[model samples]
Target: MSLLASEDLAEGTHNVKQGLPDLLRNTHDVTSQWMEENTTKEETELNDWANLPHVVLENVFEQLNEVSLLRAQFVCKRWYDVIRHSASLWRDKSFRFSGRDPRDLTHGPYKYASSFTRTFGRYLERVEFKLFSPVTSSVCKKFQKCVKICLNSLIKTKAHLKDFSMPALQLDRSQWMLYREDMCSALARFFCKSQHTFERVDFPGTRANFDDGYKILYALGYNTGRTVTHLDITDMMISRRPMFDIPQFVECFKHFRCLQELELNYSYISEDLLEVLAANLQENSLQVLSTSVTQHDPHNQVIWGHSWAALANRCRDLKVEFYFQRVMTYEQHFRILLPQIPLSEASFDGCYFADRDWQIRPTIASILPRFQSTLERLIIELPDTREVFETELLSLLSLCPHLWYFKMSAYTSTRFLDKLLEAVSEKRCNLSVIKVRIYVRDYDTDHEEIDLERIYTKYRDLITNDLIDYYATCCVSM
Candidate 1:
């Protein structure tokens, strides 16, 4: 009995040892299978990324505008590195925002974008913000705070912006109860911000105080280490006395050492004021200057030979547009206007030379030769009432060689068209564009007209065949 029991124990031990090996092998197989599944998923994802086209990947990130591009620096390490180093990418994008209340907070589509902008502000190159009505003192303060937040957000990003634009804060006539002082204070703070990040500034029509405008100018001058290349000041409401009396316009401009173009158009500019302005430009880098004549200012009368000659000498290119108070005879007009036409480069707009007393043709013939060589563009606004000037007009065209653009809106008989064809043929005039609007209101209906198409065919070989770029017409019937 003892021998049989020992044999049974040995058999049981052998069975247990075999079972342990099987158990260990099964556990190892399950672990290995799980690891294989996980590794396969990782490899599949990597392969998908590798298969993506290069252009697709680049376009996905590079298609954003300037402001959104600036604000997107914080998206990830890859995006941050891309925008922080690329300046040329942001050159063509415009960045503008409004300064009004936010009435809604729905996270519809741009939740991710809005968050990005808040993260990195003012890396944007340009911004335009709108201001709504009911512009009260409290609303202005709130708007000021919003601007401060945006500015502070921008300052934190360490982005170097090159251009910025904003609208003037409009005043509500109904809300006279609003504090003017508060609004002025808000603007003062706003201008302080504007004095930075701009190389060229234009304010077309701002209903602000003259002092306020000058203050903004002062801030711009004080802040910028060097003056901008171009400055435009226009549409300010200045009376005859106060316009000439102010010295800030001339003095403030002297600060810009590199100013090249200055346009003082549609403003109440005086001859004495212009003289002061010209004196500042005497030896500076000023190249192109434009201004209009207003008859209200007695100081703006034609000291043409002196004032215009001085400016023509100072500027390499000049353009002057004068609105007429009364029509003058061609002889009288030429006396004042001809001397101002620069021999190098010049342009004239919105002037009339009408003479009822004597013949106007000879004076026009004499005056047209000055534009023969150097004039690039001529825009003449003709008198509404018409008189015969066909011979004079043909003579003028005969003198102009290498004329690029010619626009005429006046009365010209069909006889003048024949002369024009002859001049084009004889001179082989290399005209790029010709815009003619013949007033055909008072023509006789019974007469047979000259065929323009026939003339075109006669000189078809001689006519310059540069393909017409644009065409639109309003046909007139007699």
Candidate 2:
């Protein structure tokens, strides 16, 4: 009886609801009708985008590149507010200026890169200006003008930058010398301004001098000495000339206590200089010290065994990598390479010097064993003047367990490959890639010298394989 009474009550409520026409309309339908009646055209057309939170707008703005961001800000007042105030989107990006850029070229070094700094200089953190290349003497003056404009704009809108990469201009020899001083003066002032926050400074191949009591470098070292971590001022002017002073440089080096990676000229590294560096570098931070070798560095016959050993002792992880600008004479090679210095990655562009009088074959293998525990990569570019026996090279490979990549521009043979594969399999060597540019002789031609000359031509040399270098492909594939 109670169940039947409950069913009757439900039926009564359903009938009541249906009886009232106003109640028949759902709450959603009624609300829609009310909104249609009361809302104005302006209120209805309101964009839902304006309701987005500040965090969401900043995130969306951050996705855009500099130019795109600049454009997006003009979309509305809300977007402009977000982009104008946000700091993360502006700092730590690379801006390149080139002749190809569409900016008004007649104005200065480059408006494309400088324009960004000029607009948002207050939010600046990392600024890198990479100039357009293939410059001639006529365009250098314009280049100088552009640099000055860019520098002036950057200085005016001064803010501390973490990374600064001033272009190492590749102008004609006379042209570079003519404008180098003006560039350096501007750079010194820039460096002074950047001293408080300059963490990593790279002015490679600029040959920036330290005359006038080393003012440019002094500002960098003395101001941010303990803070600067990665300094790569390679090819700096530090000679026995009237303006250059080695002792002052040593003092400057003393200030680099926090340096982790350094690349300077091999000529400047004397006993006293390296000693100061070894003493100053923080523990384990100084992993790799790279230097560029010029032909003249061999004359400075300072025994680096003790000083390098001291550095190695302090930072057991230190590895010294040197780049040879020219074919190294055998005596010069021996003089510079010290056993104490840990060499992890080596690039020997040419092993033969002066009519094959100095070849790396016999001596290189003997020297390889010393760096067996450390060496991981080796690149050897040999002139095809003489055919080298693979015995020494294979022996070196066997000793070096860590070697991952090996590239040789040479005459490789079947016997060498067979031995190399056998060695790789036997030792389970860590060697990952083996690239060899195999030189082929034209047997069809009767003139042997002519054939050899044609074979040795820079880019036309066909490999033993029809495709890529068989030596590299075979080793990698296997």
Candidate 3:
């Protein structure tokens, strides 16, 4: 029955979703009547509203959402006292800081609730930083303050810290030298207190140089690593003067007894750790190992003959992802990316690294032969607007028979993309999505990024010669 006309709902509201909305429409009047009728003369005479059975008020409060439930506290002094004193009321209610600025936590919409958070935070499931870009060096100190504040409020009422995703902290060289160690210590305390029964652990954009993000990670690996199902540190970078080296990660990744999905960058994982990684895989766990092809110790180490077969034998679902950051020398790519390992995804960040000395880049022709059948997705990115692929990508479409998603991004040149549109029409390939990135000088103007989807998608034929010609003429100004 509809809410407006239903007598049954008004009398006996069964579901919380159905009852809460109508009840919220008249909070003062309904709650006043509840206080009046639900209490006895002896209890009501002395202003003893606390004597109104706990279960009766709890049933009503439990049906309400966070905002309504919080509002319910002001009905009486007893109501305020009950909510403030009781732990279970706020236990499962999440404390979320989805704002971009530190001021948002201090002075914005959450300003009113800051006191509430401070009062009964430990019972909260977890503190979450949501829907914000990684903070820069300038505001890293302020952001870290917000993080510490949020964590500090959570007084450990129970040893039931389920899952945790550390907030993004992208500090510059100067910020790292000054603020990183103190912030690390703060996070270390949080982990030490509530490090039990975690099922998912994620620390994105972690810089693993020195003792930067190491102490926090070591604390985690020390406790909940054996139980976490998904462990993601893919975007972590450790170039030089590393602290959490190969052997530490070997011991760390070893503790994941029930790990189903792991995302690790090459800097954290080495050739020596691959065997350990292989052995740790549960029956269905798939490892997405990342590599930046360079003349580094582990990047240049051979994996084809030794641990590659062992990984394939143990885990059929093993998928390796390549990130061609800066300079991708052929020596490292060929050495590790062997026939036995299933090469699922390949990404080109740039054609060359910062180092000026020119090294031989392995062509797609040479590097992809072994796992062409296994290849599912190929992404090519050119940081320089003028830069295009060293090798033509038109032939790459045919090389990988099982390729699903092909993306050419971060470049202004649409010439290769035009050729791809022309070729894919005639000779059918297995490509499901073709994503191309085009650049316009001004960031604000509305423009559609060219996405040539599956054969059946109506928009596939939309990218005609006429459209490409139109794009070429007006792309620069757009």
lDDT of 2 at 276: 83
lDDT of each: 0.51, 0.66, 0.59
Name model 1 segments beyond 4 Å from true. 1-60, 65-122, 127-161, 166-197, 236-242, 266-268, 272-284, 292-304, 317-338, 341-373, 381-390, 409-422, 428-430, 437-464, 467-472, 476-478
lDDT by residue (6-51, candidate 1, tens digit) is: 9999999999998998999999999999989999889788666444
* TM-score per candidate: 0.64, 0.76, 0.63
Name the candidate that leads on lDDT.
Answer: 2
Candidate 3 global TM-score = 0.63
Clashing pairs in 1: 95-126, 95-127, 96-127, 96-128, 97-129
Please say which candidate is ahead in lDDT: 1 or 3: 3
List clashing residue pairs in candidate 2. Answer: 108-146, 109-146, 109-147, 434-472
Candidate 3 structure lDDT: 0.59
Give the C-alpha lDDT of model 2.
0.66
Deviation from native of the Cα of residue 313 in model 3, angstroms = 2.8
Worst 10 residues of 2 by lDDT: 469-478
For residues 325-394, write the lDDT of model 3, one tens digit per residue: 6545565566656777778888766652334332323456677767778888887655443434434456
